[model samples]
Target: MAGKVQKIKDWKGSEQKGTLKLQEAEVPRAALTDAISEDILCDLAELFKVFGDSTRIKILYDLFSGEKNVTEICRDLEMNQSAVSHQLKILRTAKLVQGRREGKSIVYALADEHVKMIIAMGIEHTEE
Candidate 1:
């Protein structure tokens, strides 16, 4: 059977001027079958959402160098302890940051090299 051609329409419920015909093309079934699962796609989207907030990005940037207590983070970022802690909680839940008890305070740092690479790539992209 011949491929189907679709009419390109415009907003006024009429055929557009100088309209181009769109033909259905054969898709690779293997590519579709090998695509990531919907659950994994949703999880990846959620992870990117965690990086969407400026406050969280600032917190991650601060933790890039070394582990820091909440007080030190607040002092460096000039943010309040409560605000910094709140952002940290979200970061921890996303597994982007990890914290360990240091004496009376909890020191926080990036969870792994993946986080650093992601941030570094983002910075490089923006610079370019």
Candidate 2:
């Protein structure tokens, strides 16, 4: 198993001492330090949690095409306004989507290019 770490365990199911193997190339020290902060790690976890909901994922996929209001999302997803709005609030809080006032309605869109890239990469990974 290239690039895999193997932890040797004893009969009691406890990890053995000094049997850890890093069989592949070592990870860069800079890469290790860059992601070590607890706050950043927790934030990343929270962001992924936001993506765990099917409703939120559909809303994000809908927004990928362009900005749409609550009504449009509900119609497109065949859901009620309340449910769509609730998921939209979650998406907005996670900074995955943004809304702006247009006349009397609020049009929602992907927060930025990073969000599009994230969704695109996710789709690509799942398709494979």
Evaluated against the true structure, the overall lDDT of model 1 is: 0.76
Residue 106, model 2, lDDT: 96
For every candidate in turn, the CA RMSD to the true structure comes to: 15.7, 14.2
Reference-based lDDT, residue 92, model 2: 91
lDDT of each: 0.76, 0.74
C-alpha lDDT of candidate 2 relative to the true structure? 0.74
Candidate 2: regions farther than 4 A off = 1-33
Give the TM-scores of the predictions, in the order they appear.
0.72, 0.72
So what's the TM-score on candidate 1? 0.72
Model 2 residue pairs with clashes: none
lDDT tens digits, residues 1-120, model 2? 433433322111114421222222334455544546898889999999998888898898777667899999999999999999999999999999999999999999989856755665
Candidate 1 residue runs with Cα over 4 Å from true position: 1-34
Q: Report how far residue 37 has shifted in candidate 1, in Å.
A: 0.7
